[model samples]
Target chain A: MSLLQTIFEETFKISYEEANQDLAMQDVANWDSLTHMDLISAIEDKLAIRLSSDEIADMTSFDAIKRIVNEHQ
Target chain B: MHNIIVFGTGKISESCSYYLTKKYNIFAYVCDNDFVTDEPFLGKPVIAIDSVAKSYPPNEYAAFVAVGYQELNTLRESKVEQLTTLGYQLVSYYPQHTPINGPIGHNSMIMDDAVIQPCVTVGNNVLVWGGAMVGHHSVLQDHCWISGGCAIGGGATIGERTFVGINATLGNAITVGRDAIIGSGAICNKCIAEGSVLITAETPTYRLNSHQFIRFSSEFNSRN
Candidate 1:
């Protein structure tokens, strides 16, 4: 499994199958603002990449997060 | 004295260790393998969390997640949950200089000079910083951050992961919702809803009673 997928599964308590590109914050039960920040921090730490406030705010979906990760890469 | 392993190498961990050393002997500072450093913390060796269970063992020592109230205390809560999952008994720190006539839940921290009045229920992973005063019969929910010098009135219910900023006054019998951020110097008497960002230039006094606070507190209790 991809690192991002694993992080999503752990953070949202979702299955690996559910942590796809179509996944959105509204679909997750535990996707509150605090948990969202946790997800961002986890991503930054695991990927060794920093995300700006705007990118963090816009990363409401898995697709958006992937786009930001691509930009950092 | 029992040996306690503190998680983190930052200032909060240093402060926690200073108090923890008074009651228990600090074993080592625990951090993730990714962030492990060569230098010691507060004169003790730093151990990786993954290897701590093998070296120290959970049955022999206790753990204190001394992480600060970052991400609205969720980070501390996560560390507490991690330690619990590893079968480590979590310990709460009740600072000296006040007799807390209340029950403080596991992993909660009462910093120096923080007063907890009678019948207060401090939930798990709550962080009450120095000089904070929680009045009688208040309910501080899990993962809440009561900043330094904040005065919480009696019978008030602080919501989960909510941050009552420095010197913020939560009037008597008020209820603040989960994830709400009350800025510094705000004296709030209103029922703050979940995810609210309340910023005040001056203390705004408004009385909200008759079941609103009760409702929010009940939801908070039922969740935990």
Candidate 2:
């Protein structure tokens, strides 16, 4: 499994296969304001990266998160 | 005196850099990678942030992120995180004559004449501009900016990155959520949800223009 899948599955309690760039907050079962923060923390920790406050707020889609991760890398 | 590296060249930075001189020896002003130049700021050398650690090692010199309230202070938050990860210790600034009666976090600044009442908990990267009054037991969360002359009532809880604008007033025990904006001169007395914007109505002039009003009001009042 990809690192993004692992992180998303771990943070949102979703299956690894369900984690994709097309996925968003509404598509996920348990995504909320609190869990979104958890997802951000997980992404930052696993990627060894830091996201700006705007970045954290704007990362609604899995695609956006992947984009940020790629850009930072 | 402690050696300090100030990050930013804008007005807020200039003011804090001046006030910081009271406690710290000025080292230099650092710039973002995009704003690199040989020009000096406030008569101090401006160094590129990318190479600041090489000449002014973080082990010896402390850092202050003097960025202003752009992007609801998220910009400053980003800079603080960047600088901290680079191994520099962040420092808070309380200008001369500013009264701080509570616990404030790192890289925050309380400007001149601002009064922090007892037991107020101020979080990281907060900016309280000049003449602001934060009431007792209020909790100001991280990355918030309280503009000049703002009066926050006692026991109010301000969430992260919330902006209380100039001369705004908040009633006692109000809870303002994250990413909220209480505009200038607004009087807020109730709880606000996240991402709320409270803008006061613009004051409209009289039907007559200023000159016409001045000419007509001489009998009643000339202050128009």
Candidate 3:
């Protein structure tokens, strides 16, 4: 899956179209701490890769997340 | 009456002993894995845990796992399964002092001294530690642990596998997502999304009459 699509699906638990740069971190209703960990766990499980604590902490925006995921790829 | 034996000597186990012994004629009170208590608990003989099988057949007794929350809920889950596979019926204990409004599903170990207010929904295999209070209309999903002295407010929904730390307080109308850990003594006034970790800043204390030229304790107390 594309990184953008993954982020959108992860943040919103919705389809790819819902994922956009305009998506605010706090706007999503389900974007609680438990779901945040679920998103990270899902991404790692899907791509078979682990994200560093620094990378995880720094990930707050779609653009920054794209960069981190692309580097992992 | 059915033969119900409570394992472990923890506070929960003791409460179970006190309650169940009054209701049923329990065969023996299982103490430590090795030594049995000389006196009976509430008039039932107290024996060691390991001697459970030796004294009676596995089918002869129903066992309740009264141990507290282990590392990551591992200890309770493992012991529940172990007792079941041994052909012993798994018993659940819920205190009547807890005012549960909605249906509490199977195998819940609710300790004494906890106050579950009205309109609270608790799922199966859950543990409500002693002195915890579930406020009215709060929905707690399955496998959640509400530690001792924790207070969940009304109109809150705690998702599955979540751990509410000791004395953590959630304000009314807040929603905590699945698998979230509310740190000890945390006071949440807003919705915590799934998997979030929250901590509250701790206040320092000092002796009231240390000649420190100030007194803050009485002032803080009166304000609240």
Candidate 4:
């Protein structure tokens, strides 16, 4: 499973198949502000990295977040 | 009376000036050199922050930072640190109606109609806006901003530099971490991690017209 898929599953309680790059905060049913924060937290924990406020705000899609995580790592 | 200097000339600074005038002697309003205007604020001179220490020695005149939440409260936090480093004693403002049962940190502001229940710990540079409620035993860390009508439940812990929007609520024993932002009308029952931003779901709008229903009701009333 991909890192984004794991984050979506753990933070939003969604299936791995549903956690695709196309899935975004606006498109996903469960990706409200609360879940968005949870996802950020989960990503930070799994990756062992902290994200700035601007970075958190820019994470609108799974693809964008994955790229950011890759860059940080 | 103790001589005090108010930093900033914004709305929060104006409110702080109004509150501080009753107890202390407000010497002047201090801000950046670019923000300095010719006109006086509340009949006191608005001077540059860099020049304030030279005129009014830090030992003689204390300072109060009246800036509101900007940059998710990081700005206010930085201002507090800067003023402290300049050797100025930071002053706190609490309205007469607000009841603080426990010790609150310096440079904090508790506006009118806000209630701080027993055993609550409020840290430095915190801002509790009007009509907010801090439940018993709750801990609000340094540089946090609790907006109007927020209800923080008992024993809840709000981490440093967090921003709680107006009318937001937190369940008892919940913990919100540093740099968090809880949007207006949001209700949180679980613990929130650091740098989290939580907001309520938008309300769905209906397509039905209310004017048609009103017309039908009037016709039925006339027939009866």
Candidate 5:
């Protein structure tokens, strides 16, 4: 699985099939503000890239996160 | 009076500067080279972090990193490391009104109205915002951020870099692991694993109209 997919699956405790670019915060049951921070931390830990609060706030969807990871990489 | 330089010009830095001005002489505000600004901060000169060492030597002046908890507190941690590497004495903020019975680590900011009970040990670079209560004998590890109005019970051990949101409550003797995130209004009773995230369930709102449920005094008088 892709890095983004793996992050979504582990952080959200969702299945790989449920993790997709179209998946948004509103679509997930456990994607609260706390989980959002956890996801950000997880991404940072896995990718070794630090994200500012603005970047974290802008990550509303999987596609946005992918874009952010790409930009940082 | 001891001269101290405050890093950053954000709200946290401003508050820390204000807190330090009472006891120490405010030397200057230091920011990154990329932060473009020529304005004076609270009537003090704003200089770049790299340039601070030249004018204000580490032996003569101290430093306080007033950055907030961002990126799971890694940003604040990095600033702490940078300030320490510069050989500046890192100062902590503990308001006179806030009772600290035990040792609090350097570079931590315990804001006003925070009640830290006896035997509470707070680690370095921690930020316990206003009105937060750290119960007796609780231990907060390095780089933790406890938001305003949080109630951490006695004997609780909060791990490194954990972020406890506003109004969260942790029960007595509970151990929260490293890099954990406790959401606002969450009541944690059990131990939280490392890198875990705990969020409270959203409160369900009632949809019934209040006026429809009220019993009028006139109706009671008519019945009498």
Candidate 6:
């Protein structure tokens, strides 16, 4: 699995195939604000990198998330 | 006119009993199912929860379930339902110190430094620990533990017994399942399962200040 896919799957506890942009951050009813913090922490932990607040805000889509990961490296 | 009874022997319950002592007319403290004590808690007898109904007579007084965790919350919820069914009113407490702007259930403990925002629905026996913030429209189910320094965003739903670790942050509109363990400093953006444990990254050891002993003298201590 790709890095983005792995991060999403592990952080969200969903299958890699299940994580898509359409299942957007507020689109999922169960994905509350607290869980968003958890997701950020999880991603940050896994990647060993810090995310800028602007970058964190901009990462609302799968493609955006992919770009963020790419930029980290 | 209101008779209060506290359940459980935990520190939280003790603190609740102590805090409420001055504000309410506490009659007894019922620890668990069978333990009862006559020691005056704020000048009232500390009795066990089970014996309160029998000793005090349900018609005359009300009770507060002071137990912790989801199991006890569930039990107290059922008991409250039963008591209400039997025509006894369950007392609801919202400490003025905690900023509660929404529907907080009976038997919940809103400790010192808790900031409960608008539209939050906190269920019974919930522990909003010190320095915890419940954002707008959040729904924390019965027995949830919003640990000290934890920040929950708006419209979040925390399942029963979900223990949010210290300084853990959750985004808005998230749902964490029952018994979920969010590790300290974790930033959550996704829904967690009933037993899932989500941990955050620790700062590298090299960057952390590991120095334990700083050079100090008695003269330095005495000086300005």
TM-score of each: 0.65, 0.71, 0.56, 0.69, 0.68, 0.59
Calculate the i-RMS of every candidate, to one decimal place: 12.0, 25.8, 17.2, 20.6, 21.6, 20.5
Q: Candidate 2 residues B52-148, lDDT tens each?
A: 9997999999999988788988888999998999899988877554434455699888876788777788888888887899998899999999998
lDDT of each residue in A7-48, candidate 6, tens digit only: 677667776567754355544444443455566687788888
- Candidate chain B TM-scores, in order: 0.85, 0.93, 0.70, 0.89, 0.88, 0.74
Judged by DockQ cut-offs, the docking class of candidate 4 is incorrect
Tens digit per residue, CA lDDT, model 4, B1-224: 77999888888888777777877899998888888989898788998978888988899999889898989878777877888898999988787645455667999988766888877888988999888999998999999999999999999999999999999999998999999999999998999999999999877542223553343223223332
Tens digits of per-residue lDDT, candidate 2, A1-73, equal 7788898888888775787547866677677655776777788888899877656656767887888889999
- The order by descending lDDT is 5, 2, 1, 4, 3, 6
- On lDDT, the stronger of 3 and 6 is 3
Docking tier of model 2: it is incorrect
- For candidate 4, lDDT tens digit of each residue in A14-45? 77777764666655666655576677888888
Interface RMSD of 4: 20.6
**For residue A57, what is the lDDT in candidate 5?**
64
Every candidate's DockQ is: 0.01, 0.01, 0.01, 0.01, 0.01, 0.01
State the number of backbone clashes in model 4: 0
Model 2 clash pairs are none
Model 6, B84-169: lDDT tens digits are 66455667666665545465776677775688887788886577876888898889887677788999999999998688889999
Interface RMSD of 5: 21.6
In the range A1-73, model 1's lDDT, one tens digit per residue, is 8899988988888887899657766566677656776788899999999877666767767888888889999
DockQ of candidate 4 (2 decimals)? 0.01
Each model's lDDT: 0.82, 0.83, 0.69, 0.82, 0.83, 0.68
Better of 3 and 5 by TM-score: 5
TM-score leader = 2
If you assessed candidate 5 against the hidden native complex, which CAPRI class would it receive?
incorrect
Going through the candidates in the order shown, the clash numbers are: 0, 0, 13, 0, 0, 30
* Candidate 1: tens digits of C-alpha lDDT, residues B1-224: 77888899999898777777777888899998999989998888899988888878899999899988788888888889988888898888786544454567888888767877877888888888888999998899989989889999999999999999999999999999999998898889988899988777763332224243343223234333
